[model samples]
Target: MHIPDGLLSMPMIIITYAITIMGIVYSLRKLKNFPEDKIPLLGLFAAGVFAAQMVNFPIIGGVSGHLLGATLVAILLGPYAAILVMTAVLIIQTLLFGDGGITAMGANILNMGIVGASLGYATYSKLKDMNEVIAIGFASWLSVVVGATLTAIEIGLSKSLPFMKVLTLMIGYHVIIGIGEAILTLFIIKAVKTKLPEIGGVPA
Candidate 1:
C-alpha cells in the first residue's frame, strides 16, 4: 500500500516524516547491540523481501497485493533489525525503482517498517511459547491487516476518498493477502530451522 505523491496532505506528510525519523533513529540504536554473526542474515532477508514484493498478485476489483514479509523478518532477525531491513528496502524502492513515491516514503516506512514489523514481533513473541507455527501464522496475518488499516486511514485523511469505503476495501483485500504472508513466513522459518538447527531453535 504505497501512497503516491500528492495523495497525502502536507500536514500528514510532515507528521509521518517526523514519526518515521524517530523510529529509524531508535531502531538503529538498538541494532548496534545485535550479534555480529547474525548481521549477514539481515542483507539476505532484505534481498528476499525485496524480490518477493516485486511479484504482485491481483485481488478483487483489480487491486493488487504482495507479500509484506515483515513478520517473517521480525521473527528471524528480531524487530529492531526488521525495521532497518524494511527501511532499506523501502528506500531503494522509492529512489531507484520509483515503486513508491518519494514524498510519501515517510508514510510508507512508518506503516510497513515500524507498525508492521513491531506489531508482528510483539504478537509472535507473546504466543510463540504456546505454539510456534500458530503464533507465526497469526502474527503474519495480523500485521498485514494492521498495516493496511493504517494505510487506509492515511488515504482517508487526505479526503481524496471515503474513509470507511477505503478502509473496508483495503482490509478486505489484505486479509486474502495475509494468508499468503502467513504461509510463506511459516515455510521459510521452518526451512531455516531445519537447515541450521541452532539458529533460534525454532520450534516445530
Candidate 2:
C-alpha cells in the first residue's frame, strides 16, 4: 500500500526523507557498470516492475497482495541496480500512476525500494552464504513483510488505525501472502539461477 501526503505527520515525513536520501545516495555510489547493452535492460525492467505493482491480488476481502519482486531483481541484477529499479518504480507510481503522493515519495522510497530491495538483498547475501534456495525464500518473504509491517506501523502511529489491531492485521495477512511471495521468488530464481551467474554472485 503506497501512502499519500497528508496522511502522515510532518515529523514522520522528515525522518523518512532523511533515510530515503541516504539510501539513494548509497545505491548510486555502489552502482557497478555493466555492459552497454545491459543498461537498457535495467530501464525496461524498472518499467515492468512499475506495471507489476498495479495489479494487486486480493488476499482476503479488503487486503491485497502484489509482487515486490525485490528479491527477484536483487538475485538477477544485484543490489545497486535492483534498488535503483525499485526506487524508480515507486517514483513513477507517485508521479504517473498516482499510487502514492509526491510529498510522501520519500516514505514510499524508504519502505518499498530501500527496505524491499537493498535490505532484502543484504539479508539474502548473508543467508545465501549457507543455502541458495533457503536464502532466496527468506529474503523475498522478509522484504514484503518489512514493507507491509512498516506501512501499518506508520499508518497506526498516524492514529488512522489502532496500533495493535493494525499491526496484527498487517503481519497476519503478510504471513500468508509472504508464502506466495517466497514460492514465486524461489521458483524464478531456481529456473534462471543456472543461467545467470550474477544471480547470486557466482561468476559467469
Q: Which candidate is the best by TM-score?
A: 1
Best by lDDT: 1
- C-alpha lDDT values of all predictions: 0.86, 0.77
Candidate 1's TM-score: 0.93
Provide the TM-score for each candidate, comma-separated. 0.93, 0.86
Candidate 2 lDDT over 1-204, as tens digits, reads 688878777778888888888888887776745444566767876876777677777777687787778667776777777778888888778888788878778888877777867778888889987998888889989988898888887777765657888889888998777777788778766765676555354211
Q: Clashes in each model (backbone N, CA, C under 3 Å)?
A: 0, 0
lDDT of 2 at 117: 79
Q: Model 1, 1-204: lDDT tens per residue? A: 788887888888898889999999998988877887877878888999999899887767777788887778888888888889999999999999997788889999988888877899999999989998899999999998999899889878977777889999889989988888888889988998898675673221
Query: Which pairs, if any, clash in model 1?
Result: none
